[model samples]
Target chain A: MNQIDLGMVDWARAQFALTAMYHWIFVPLTLGLSFLCAFYESLYVRTGKEAWKKIAKFWMTLFGINFAIGVATGIILEFEFGTNWSNYSWMVGDIFGAPLAVEGIVAFFLEATFFAVMFFGWNRVSKGFHLFSTWMVAIGSNLSALWILVANGWMQHPVGMIFNPDTARFEMQNFWEVLFSPVAIAKFTHTTSSSFIVGSLFVITVASWYLLKGRNTEMAKKSILVAAVFGLLSTAYAGLTGDESAYVNASTQPMKLAAYEGLYNGKAKADLVAIGILKGQKAPDDDTDPFLFDIKIPGLLSLLANRDAGSFVPGIKDLVYGNAQEKIVGVKAKMERGRMAVADLAAYKNARKSGDKAGSAMALQKFGVNQDYLGYGYFSQPEESIPPVKLTFYSFHLMVTLGCLFTLFFVVFLYLAYKNSLERHRGLLRLGVVSFFLGLLASQAGWVVAEAGRQPWVIQNYLPVHIGTSNIAAGNVQATFFMFLGLFTLLLLAEVKIMLKQINIGPEEV
Target chain B: MPGYSQNNIFFKWQRTVVRFYLDGFRAMTVGKALWKIILIKLFVMFAILKLFFFSDYLHTNFSTDQQRSDHVLEQITLQSKIQAVEDKK
Candidate 1:
C-alpha cells in the first residue's frame, strides 16, 4: 500500500478530466438552449408571430443536435464511474445510485419524449401541445441537472450519510439531508445560470454573425434581440450565483476556497490577488518549485467570502499546506505506534501462556498504550503530494478574468436594452460573440481549477486517490479511453459541421 | 442427466450443449448490443411506465446540476493523445 503504483491515478485523472471536458462542450448548450427554446415558444404564443415561431424552430434544430451529443457524451461518464473509479463507486454507490436512477427514470424520458414532439411534430401536434413540449424539454433538462447536482453536492460537502466499514459504503441516513444540501443548492443555482449564460451568448453570437452578413435580417434581428436579453440577464445571474457558490464553498469546502484564492495561511486582512505566482511549500514527497509570482488580489476576497471589507480568510498555508508536516508526522508515527502496540499485546499473550500473570499484566498495559494508533487509519492524504501550483494559479486567473468580463459585458448590455438600443448597438452585438467564447473559456478554466485543486483525494478527507482507482488492467483503460476518445471526437466534429452549416444559412425567412 | 434410453439421452445432451452456446451468444452479442440499449430504454419507459415520474438516474450519475453547481477551483490539465488532433471548429 505504501509503495502503490501511481500510474493508475495519473491515467484516471487524465481520462476523467478529458472526458468531462469533452462532455462539457455539449452541456452548457443543453442548459441554455432549453430555456431559450421555451422563451421563443412563449413569444410565439403571445404574439402569434410567424417570425418568432421560425426562431423557435431554428434554435430547436440546434438544440436537437446538441442534446444528442450531450446524451451520448453523458452515457460515457456514467460508465466511467464503474470503470475508472470502481472503488469509489463501491464505496459510495448506494448513496450515488439513487439520484442517478431518478434522473434516468424521470429527466431523460421527460426530455427525450417531449423533445421529439418539439422537433418533428410541427405538423403532427397542436401549437399548444408543441409549446408544452418545449416547456417539458426545459423542465426535463433542469430537473436532470438538479438530481445530478444533488449527488455531486454530496461529494463536495458529504451530508446526510455515514460510512459503514463492514460494507465499505456510505448509507444515507436522512433523505432530506441529501436533497437540500447547502452546497448543492448554491451550486445548482449558480451552475444552471452559467449554462443559461453559455446558451444565450452562443445563440446571440451566431445570430449577430448572421446579422453582420445580412442573412435573414428580420429573423436574425429578432433572434439576436431575444438572445441579448436572456444573455444579459442570465450572465448577470451567473455572476451572482458564482458569488453565492463562493460563499457556500468558503463556509463548507474551505480547502477549495483557500486554494482558489491561493491563501497559504490565515491573515489579519487578506489582499485578494488579482495576479501572483502560487508557489509556496510542497510536501517532502513533492518536488514542485517554492516560488511563483504576480498573485494580486486587493480586498475582493474578503468581500466575496464574508461580505466584509477586511474579514480574514484562512489561507491554504494555515490549513492545508501549513499543517502538512503535522499530518504526515501524525500518520506515520501513529501507524508505527499501532504496530508496536499489537506486538506488545502478543507478548502479553505469550507471558500468560507461561503462567506469569504479573508480567502479562504489564505487557497488556504497554499494549493498551499503543492502541491509540488506530486513529491514524482515518488520516487520508491528498491525491497530489504537491499540486501543479503554476497551472492552478493561471487557471484561477482565467476563470476570474472571464467572470469579471461577463459581469461588465452584461452590465453594459443590460443598460443598452433599457436604452432600447440593443438591436442597433453593433458594438454590444459584437461583444456578445466574444463573451460567448469567454464564457466557455471561463467554464473550462473553472473545471480545471476545481478538479486539480482537489488533487489526490477522490473523496476529500476520506479516501486517497490511489486507493480509489479501479483494479483493472492498464491496457483495458487505454483501449477504452482511446475508443471513446475517437468516437467523441467524431461526434464533436459532426456537431460543429452541422452547427456551422446551419449558422451560415441563418433562419429561413418568415 | 435425463432418465431415458441411450438415443434419447444423447439427443438431450446435444440440445443442452446447443442451448448453452445460444445463451452465451445472447448475453455477449445480443444483450450488450444496441438492441439491448433500446430495450432498456423501452422497459424503463413503456413497459414499467415510470420513466417520466422517476428522476433518480439523472440526479446521481449524469446531472449537469452537480457539474455546474460544484465548481471547485481545482485546475487539472489533461493530455489526451487518443484521437487524431483535428481542428476544433
Candidate 2:
C-alpha cells in the first residue's frame, strides 16, 4: 500500500520516449510514401509511361531507406516493452500483447515478406507482380500501423478486458471490442491521415525544390499535382478524426480534455481557446491562473467535447474539487475507492491462500465494484492527479494551428498544381517547402498531446506508469538508455547521409 | 484508384502478398544458400537466442500471482539506487 520510489522509472520513460520519437521520424513517411509509390506505379502500369515509373522508382528508393530505419527503431521499440516495462508486459500482456504480437506475426511478416519482392523482384518478377508487390508493401505497412495503434488505443481507453486477480493481469474478454474500439478507430484514421499529410508534404517539398532548381520540372510538376490532391484529402480526413478523438478523450479522459482546453472551472456551454498565450509562470501542478489572454469561440468546446452545445463541461477545479455540478468524480474520492479496490484484491488473494472461500467471495465482490478506479489507488494525493496542463494546452493548440495552416496550404497548392501554375508562384512553392517541417511539427505535437496529456497513467484509469516499469536497477537502465541513444543517433545520421546521396543520384541515374 | 472500395483494396492487397510469398519462395530456390543463411540467422536470433536470454522474470521468480505482483510493487515502491545516489548528492 505504501509507495515505492523507483528511480528506474524515469530512465525507462526517457528510453521509451527516445525510441518512440526516433521511430516516428521515419514511420510517418514510410506509411504515406508507400501509397504514393503504389499510386505512381499504378499509373505507369496503366499508361505505359516511363516517367511515371521513374517517379515511382525514385520515391520507392526513399521509401526503402525510410522503411529500413523505421524497422530498425521499431524492433527496439517492441523489445523495450520486455526490457523496460516488464511489469506492464505481464500486467496487461494478455490483452495488450495480443495486438502487438499480431502486429509482428501478421502485419510485420506481410511487410517483410513482400518487401523482398518489392525491392529485389523488379528484376526477377513480372511487371504486374512488381506493381502488386509495391501495393502489398503499402498495405502491409499500414496494417502494421493499425495493429499497433489498436494496442495504443486500448491503453488510452482500456476496453474489452477483465482483470483477473488470481493472474494479477488484465486479459482479453472480447477480441472484437478490443479491435474495433471507437478510440482505436479514430486514432487509426487520425494518425494514418496525418502520416499521409506528412508524406504528401514530403513529396510537395521535394518537388518544389526541384522546380526551384529548374531540374526534373515535368516530374516535379506531375508529382505535385498528385501529392497536393492527396494531401488536401488526407488533411480533411485528419480533421474529422481529430474531432472524433477530442470527443472520445472527453468521454474517457475529461481531465486531459480540461487541461488541454485550459479549463479551470466548470462551465455550461464552455468556450474554446481559439488563439491565446497560456501563462507559463506556474508549475503544472500549481493552482495559479491558466492563461494571461485568450480568444475563445463561445460554446465550441462544449459542442466539440460533448456534442451538445449546452452540456455542462467540468474543468480542472470542478473535476478536482467536487463542485455542486459534480458531473465528474473528484480525484480524492476516486483514490479512496481505488484504495478500497486495491485492499479488496489483496484481501481476496490472502483469503484464497488460506482457503477462506466465503471471505474471498466478499472481497472479490467489493473489488469488482471499485476495480475501475483502481489506478488512482497508487496516487498519494489529489495534486498527483493533475497532468502537466501547460504543456498539454500548448501542444494541443500548436498541433491544431499547424494542422489548419497545412490544410489551407494543401488546398491552394492542389488548385495551382491542377492548373499547372504551381511553379509560377515561387512564394507559394517556398511556403509548400516550409509546410513540410510544419506538418512534421504538427504530427510531433499531436503525439506529445496524446502521450503527455495522459500523464501518470500508462493505461488510463487502470495502471500508473511509475508502478508499471520493469524491476531493473536504475543504473542498468540508464546505461542502456545512453547506449541505445548513441546507436540510434548514429543510425539516424547514416540514414540522412544515404538519403541525401540517393536524392543527389536522382531518378535519371537509377 | 480513387473509386477502389476499401474491401477490394484489402482483398487485392491480401492476394498480392500471398502471390509474392509463393513467388519469393520459388525464386529463393535459385539463391538457396542465401535464403538458408538469412532464415537461419533470423531463427537463431529471435527464437534460439531469445529463449536463453529473455526469461520471463515474473514466471521464474514467483509461482503465485500474488507473489509476482507483490515483488513488482516492492521493487517499484522501494527507494531505488538512483534515488540513493540523488540523496547522497
Candidate 3:
C-alpha cells in the first residue's frame, strides 16, 4: 500500500540473477562431469588398465576443482531468500523449503561423504568400493539437482499447495505431488541432461587441447571416445526434454511460450521462428511488425504448443488483451478479480476480529473464488504482465540454435573418434576446444529463458516480485551486488586457473 | 557377543577410512589447491558476507515467530485495504 520501492525490487532481482547465473556456471559441469568420472572409472575397473584409471583420475581432478569452488555459492542464494525476498520466503517457505532442506540434508551429505572416498580411496579401498563411491558421488550430485529443480519447478508452475489465509502462507498439501509435478520432472531431466552436455564438452575441449599440443595423445583419444559418446546421448535426451519443456510451457506459462516464438497475435496455426531479427521494441498492442527479417516453419509453433498443426496458439497481445473465441482471460480481468480477492481477504480478517461470522464467511468465499488471480492485483497496468519479449525471444532462440549445433558437433566428433581419425581433423579439434564455451553460453541462455520469461511473479499468479522483496534500501542491495560480482569473479578465475593447470600437467602426472 | 564383535569390526573399518582420508589429504598434490579454494570461499561466504551483509530480516527485527508471521500477514493484507480505500474514494 505504501509506495513500493521499485529501485529496491529491481536491485534485489538483479542481485539474485547475478548470483544464480554465476552459480549455474559451476553446477552443470558438476552434474555432468560426476557421471562421466563414474563411467571412466567403471571402464578402468572392467579393463584393469592403468591408462583408463589415469584418464578417470584426470577428469575427476577437474571435477574436484570445479566442485570445491562451486560449493558455497548456493548458500548465498539461500541467504538472499531470507534477506532480500523475506516476504516471498514467508509466503511459500513451507512448500519451497521442503525440497531445499531435503537437498541439503540428504543429497549434499551423500555427495560429500562419497566425494572424499572417490578422490582418496584409490589405494586405501578396493577398486570395487572406489568405483561404487564414484557412482554414488555422481548420483548424489544429480539428486541434489533434482531437489533444487523441483523447488524451482514449483515456482514456475505452483501446484500441490493450499493457501492458508489464517497463516498467510501456502502449505504443502501433498509432498508427492510437489516432487512429481510434471513441470518439476521435465525441468530436472532437461537441466541435468544439458549439464551432461556441458560436462562432456569440457572433457572433449581439454582433451582436444592435448591432442592439438601433440601431448598425451593416448589419454586424449581415450577421453574423447568416452566424452563424445556420452555427449551425443545427452544431446538427444536434452533435445527431447527441451521439447517436453515447450509443451509444458504452453499449458502452464503461455506468455513464456508466446515470447519464445515472438508471437504477437493469436492464430489457429502459428509459425515457429526458426531464425529472425526483432524490429527493436514495440508496445504490446502496437500494429507494427514484430520482426525485421525472418524464416519460419509453418504451423510448427501450433504443433509444438498444442500437439496439432491446426490447433490455435495464443500470442503476447492476446495474452495481455484477452482472446474471446479462445476463452482466454485477460490480465485486466484477472487484475479486477485479484483486487477483489485482496479486498475480500482484508475484509475477512477485519470481520473475524469483530466476531462477525456471517460477514467473515462471505468475504472468505469471495476471496476463494478470485484467489487464482491474486498476483495480478499488484500490477498497475495490463502490459506489466508481459515479460521482456526481446530478452526471452533471443535467449530461447540462442539456446535452440546452439542445441542443434551441439548435436552436430557431437556426431562429427564421435564419428572421427571411433574411426581413430580425430587427430587428423585439426580444424574440428579446434572447434571442439571452442565448443565448451558455446556449451556454457547455451546453458546460461536456457536459464535466462526460464527465469526471465516468468517476470513480475515470484510465484506464478500468486505473488508479484515487488511485494516479494524485503523492505530494504536500494543502496544496500546495490552494494552487495557489486560485492558478489567481485567475489564470484575471483572464484571463477581460481576455478579456471586450477583446472587449466591440472589439464596441462596431464593424466600421466596423476 | 556377536553384535559386539560386529560393532568392533565396524569401528575398526571406520577408523581405517578416517585414516585413509587424513593420509590422502596430507599427500595431495592438486588437492591442496582445492582445499585452499574451498576454505577461502567458505570463509568469504559465511564469515564475511553472511555475518555482515545478509541477515534474515524477520528474525533480526522480530524476536518471536508470532511477531514475524504477524508482520508478514499485515504486509500481504494491508496493500489490499489501501487499494479498497482508494477505489471507494
Q: Identify the leading candidate in terms of DockQ.
A: 3
Clashes per prediction?
A: 53, 3, 0
For residues A1-510, write the lDDT of model 2, one tens digit per residue: 233336678878888888788778888999999999898989999999899989987888778777655564566665677766777877877886778788877665778767887866765678899899899988888988998899999999999989887767788999999999988998899999999999999999888888887788899888888888888899899999999999998888888898889888768899999987888565434667677989999999999999999988888887776675555678889989987877787788778879999999999999999999888777776766778888888999999998888888888988888888877899987887677778888888899899888887899987888767765667866776776677668667767777777776677865
Q: What CAPRI-style quality would you assign to candidate 1?
A: incorrect
Candidate 3 Cα deviation (angstroms), residue A269: 1.7
Score candidate 2 by DockQ.
0.09
Which prediction has the highest lDDT against the true structure?
3
Per-candidate Cα lDDT values, in order, are 0.64, 0.79, 0.89
Candidate 1 lDDT, tens digit per residue, A406-500?
Answer: 66676675566556565677776777667678778877887777667655456654554655555455555665566557756866776777667
Give per-residue CA lDDT, model 3, range B1-89, as digits (tens).
Answer: 55666459787898887788799899789988888888888888888899999999888989987777777767776775335324533
The regions of model 3 sitting more than 4 angstroms off are: B1-7, B80-89
**Pairing residues by index, what is the TM-score of model 2?**
0.87
The CA lDDT at A405 in model 2 is 86
Of candidate 3 chain A, the 10-residue stretch with the lowest lDDT total is A1-10
Candidate 3 lDDT tens digits, A38-118: 999999999999889988998998888898899878989999999999888888889977898899887757888888899
Provide DockQ values for all models, in the order shown. Answer: 0.02, 0.09, 0.44
